[model samples]
Target: MKWVKIKKAEINEWNEKLKATHASFFQYPYYASGYTFFLFSKPLYIKLVNDQQQELGYSCILNVGAFPFKAGLIIRGPVFFKTNVDHRSSLIALKKFAVKERYTFLRVNANEPAIEELLNTDSEFEHKDYFPSYKGSQGIDLNIYYKPFDELLKSFRTDCRNKIRFANEKNYLFEKVKTSTDLEKVYDLFVGLGSKKKFSYRPLKSYTKIFKEGIKHELCSVYTASLDGRIICAAFIVKDSQSFTYFSGALELQNIPAKYSPANNLHYLIMQDCFYKEDRKIYNLSYSPRESGVYMFKTSFRPEEICKPGFYTYVINRKIAERIFSLQGKSISAIRTKLRSIIKLFNK
Candidate 1:
């Protein structure tokens, strides 16, 4: 198999190819653009083909870090056109490409179980421990869209159903955000939530660019829930041809009553909106640890657990890669500590 590098001029064709396959949002060009803007990672689009020059799959990799210690990341991809395609050859080609480009290592978090099995069986690839990728996510089958609204509602757990109804009864206005000004309001809610939850999030400018580009390409939707003209909850959903992935969400828990269910209601509306869209068959709730409260909340929706092989790393130069990984981890930890301190100060 051979890998063909795709240039920026061919992105339209790349997008067309993606539409014909079951590629995820992470493989989309706009999604990569966001990382490029904020993280300064260079996007590398490559198409895999057999010796016969027939297309088998495509990968959107992000090349990160500096010279002599660069890493190539395949985030949730190398989306194949068919289920039976030879993933091993593709993996070999990726490794060769990374080596040829002088990368220290290559990390892949493919969405395919088969590929994961291949990586496990292969001696060259090792299970990544530090900064491991998500192994699974909760997803609702959008075929439920054909059922009656009441029947769909009945599918959820009782408490979830009650929360949805209660949220509706509270008359919180749920709407798709259209203007930039409203998006900023949603960002504020997201930042506020991150502060309260003590979690890290992308900066406002990064989110603004991402959302704007995504909206312009019809690949993203931002939803907001408000009571008395005050926003309380917001969510960002990214769409591919086959699924709507819940990317980010924030809730103003302090502003709303504990009994209020704005978050649940917002998700319900999102599901409905995704169902109405053609060819979108799945509503992905994104990743959460099985033991976490967030996992329980998502489970209340009765979504099936979709599992995948987690991250694997192929190191071209183990010594250099290990040192780079150490430094990267420390940098990330320091950043998180700084963010937590800032959030604490802001809360005070």
Candidate 2:
């Protein structure tokens, strides 16, 4: 079998064929990469075919130019099938691509079955590790597979439900905002919540853009929390297939009474109706809350287990790409070690 580089003539054909092969976020049509981005980038598609030109395996790659160091990130990616194609060789090719472009480093998040499988095999990395990750497949699925409102809360810890009830007892009201003007109150409360939680501050522009897009594509929605007429909390969710992703949420802390927690109350209202009932999508609790306080709070809303793979596939660079990739490996290893020390110091 021989593998040939894919050109523009086969763009649509490649995507359509890959769709039938795997359930990968990197392959999904809506993501930044899947969309018209390929137009500007002109992705690289490799197909392992028989003499009859019958396709046996395929993958997609992008000769991407990254910022900061202005490195060329020729990613070997979007591998759908691997029966005949060699994983190590492909990775080596990826590295070669990096070196040819004179890139300082090569970054790849190959969507494979498991990272463990790549270890102990050929092409083992010396300076490779993980960074704080962004949830992908699971995030979208939460928006795709929705549960009915009533039954959705069955898994929530009793305390979480009680908190919602408590929020109601405190006379909090939920409203669906249809216009940007209506978002002001929700935005204020959300910002307040963010400050209280000591979380990162994202500009209003970001949330507004997401909310508008969600409405446009029917991909997700936003909800505002109120006590009578005064807004107290706000959240936005993105719909992905059958999953209702909990994009982000914020709640006022000090202004509200001690009887109820804003996050719990805000989440339940969305789960029971906005997402679960209205959207008919599954509720994603989002990143398994790691902060002790946040984890305690999220546990109240029991969730199902979802183990999703990270990265789509690995490609190695030849000659020059290999050296650049090696530098990247060393950098990642150093950063991970430093991060671990920081976490340790925080714990101490």
Candidate 2, TM-score vs. the true structure? 0.59
TM per prediction = 0.85, 0.59
lDDT of 1 by residue, 229-348 (tens): 888888888878877878788777665665676887788778877776445667878767779777777878888765555788888888877765665435554533543454466567
For model 1 the TM-score comes to: 0.85
| Number of the top TM-score candidate | 1
Report per-prediction Cα RMSD to one decimal.
6.3, 9.1
Report the lDDT tens digits of candidate 2 across residue range 114-177: 4325522435343342211221234211222355556766656787777767766666667678
Candidate models: Cα lDDT each: 0.73, 0.51
Considering summed lDDT, which 10 consecutive residues are worst modelled in model 2?
Answer: 67-76
Give Cα distance to truth, residue 149, candidate 2, Å. 5.1
- lDDT (Cα, 0-100) at 174 in candidate 1: 86
lDDT of 1: 0.73
State each candidate's clash count.
Answer: 0, 40
